[model samples]
Target: MNVLITGATGLLGREVFRAFQKNEWNLTGTSFRRKSPGLVRVDLSQPDTIHDFLNAHLPAVIVHTAAERHPDVSLRDPAGTRRLNVEATAAIASWAATHGAFVLYLSTDYVFDGTKPPYRPSDKPNPLNDYGRSKLDGEQELLSRAQKSSVILRVPILYGPCETLAESAVTVLADQMNRLTEPTLAIEDWATRYPTYTPDVAYTILQLVEYHLAHPDFHGIVHWSGNEGMTKYGMARVLAGQMGFPVERLVPNPAPPSGATRPKDAHLDCSALEELGIGRRTPFAEAIQAILHPA
Candidate 1:
């Protein structure tokens, strides 16, 4: 079967790329900025290019992972980000509908306001920031346009192998600690985060693809999250202990209230996906070990 992966060079997309290839699926990956050896250069921001590319090589399934994912960046350039995250996604879904291709959109927990402790797939979304709003818009687009052959997976904060060690959410703390000449590293303690492993996400996606093949009638939204609920302070402390850094070096930094509001707790309940036997998670400790010692 042919599988297409957008943002194939990104942190999560790269893992998904390897996972699909290992299963002997014919894979085609796309990248906008980076020119990877196996990836085809397709800019999602350009409607003409995206449409032409999808029409040329219509894959059986498209794992749409490409987007302007950074919240701060989205805030800075809302219009530019919306073009790719919202409009581009709508275009992709429209094309997929016409081409009879299944689209698996990788969404985020940011769709919620974060006041809720654990959100479900069926829960109504109330986004707080531009990034979250854009993602929510994209989700709506997929549901309305590609309703018959679309699956949305709402995920949480991710950390894993990337082109650089600093690209991951958890390992970035380690990188910051390594660069700090000071003995202290202040981390945000107010917000609760579910730091998921990218490899585990990749595994879950592969499982979902197989299940979709078997059960063509299945198409809806699902939730998948890491087992642990941690704050940045907690994650930094764990990383410090694991990496032999001074425990005292990590300090608590309360969440700020003035700027772009981030949800205090956007953790998801994966029971929906778990019930279908597709929500597989890696323990945070084991994931930390992998981050520390990458083979």
Candidate 2:
């Protein structure tokens, strides 16, 4: 299978690229700054360039992972967020529709309001912040333009050693643990998100692509996430315990208002993906161990 992946340097995109490469699929990747052999440099913000690239490659599937993903950054710069997240996504979906390519957009659990636990695919989206709002706009545009050939996979926080978000947390906590000092300030009150390992998410995406190829009728939003849910503080404690760090270092705190209004709970249910026999929930301990010692 010929595949094109955007944001190839990102945590999830890199994993997807690796998965496809291992499967001996004809894979080409795109990145804005980072360059690698066989990787095409296509900035999504430039639709014309992306369109031309797509015309040249003519990939059977396009897995789009590029976006302004930082919630804090999005809150600070809504326009920039929209440019990359919404407009670029729409442009790509439009191009895919014209080229008869299946587009798979990587969405987020942030699309929901966070009022409910374990959000379903059919649930109405009530984004609480600009980041979520931008992503939702992209999702709606992709659905409207790409029609039945496109798939939208909404995932929650992804954890892995190479993952920026989780790794940052891990590194900070690891440093403190090494020094026998308490790592401070975890959000115990702000109940939010479960994490999917990068490999698991990548595997699911590959399966979804294959499924779609065999069953062209398969199209729509699918919730892909880890099986478990926990607060940020709870997750921290689990991580510490798994890594043999003192659990006393983990402290309960609240999420400060930083312009971005996050949903209290945005865990996604992956029954749709499970029904397809694509992916299962990975244990948190196993995920943490993988991060500490990747092999």
* Predicted model with the maximum TM-score: 1
| Model 1: lDDT of residue 123 | 87
Per-model RMSD to reference: 1.2, 2.3
List residue ranges in candidate 2 displaced over 4 A: 163-188, 255-259
lDDT of 2 by residue, 1-295 (tens): 6788999888788888888887777888988877777777877887667777877888889999988888888988999899889998888889888878899999999999888877899999999999999999999999999978899999887766574433443334454555553355444546566768888889888889889888999999999887677766777777677677667656677754356788888888778778779875678778877777677
280: Cα error in model 2, Å: 2.8
Clashes of 1: 0
Please report the candidate that would top lDDT against the real structure.
Answer: 1
* Candidate 2 C-alpha RMSD relative to the actual structure: 2.3
TM-score of each: 0.97, 0.91
What does the lDDT come to for candidate 2? 0.81
lDDT per residue (tens digit) for residues 1-295 in model 1: 7789999999999998999998887899988898799899888988656788887787999999999888888989999989999999999999999989999999999999988778988888999999999999999999999998999988989998767768876788888988989878778888889999999999999888888899998899988889788898899988888889998878898955345678999999998788877867888888888778776
